[model samples]
Target: MPLAGPVALLAVPLGLVAFRGCSTCWVIGPTQTISSGRLERTCANGVCTLMKAGAAASPAATP
Candidate 1:
């Protein structure tokens, strides 16, 4: 049909836009997991340090 050419032309641009948008979406999954894990570990370390420091200081302040 004569309409097939124009329809294909439109599909190409739409497909390209969709592909470009989704291309980076896959990368977020692994990176997000790794970064979140790193953040949690960093937060845990910070909390542990604070707790140790507070405990150490409490004994000195008591007497």
Candidate 2:
């Protein structure tokens, strides 16, 4: 039998969220860290920072 790729991927993320719900604090791209403890997705220069709750600058995102 073959494994379902989509299901497997989804399961991994879900499992992470479930197991490490609190410690897992990050995003995949640049972000504007809000005071409310949330990461806003954005791109800056050439790298994306999974910013904390309060990032210092709002650098421009590269295309």
Candidate 3:
């Protein structure tokens, strides 16, 4: 087998492990933000709620 093939296959699992619990956030509009992933429980605005594992996003009421 070619060396490139093995390298490519190894990268897949490494990538998954590196980003397993990664979270990302996006600023939408002027005062709205959205986040996704397993590690996003709190944000800068302090209005986000803690979501249970496997649960969807559940934001707190905005003032």
Best by TM-score: 1
TM-score per candidate, chains pooled: 0.29, 0.25, 0.26
The per-prediction CA RMSD against the true structure, in angstroms, equals: 12.8, 13.2, 12.4
Put down candidate 2 lDDT per residue, 1-63, tens digits, no spaces: 257887797798778778775433555222324344575444656877666546677655799
lDDT of residue 43 for candidate 2: 62
Q: Where is model 3 more than 4 Å wrong at Cα?
A: 21-63
Instruction: Report the poorest 10 consecutive residues by lDDT, candidate 3.
Output: 25-34
Candidate 1 per-residue lDDT over residues 1-63, each given as its tens digit: 999999999897788777776656667987877666333221343564323322333333455
For candidate 3, the TM-score is 0.26
lDDT of 2 at 54: 61
Cα lDDT, all candidates: 0.58, 0.60, 0.58
Q: Identify the candidate with maximal lDDT.
A: 2
Q: Rank the candidates by TM-score, best first.
A: 1, 3, 2
Candidate 2, which ten residues in sequence have the lowest lDDT sum? Answer: 28-37
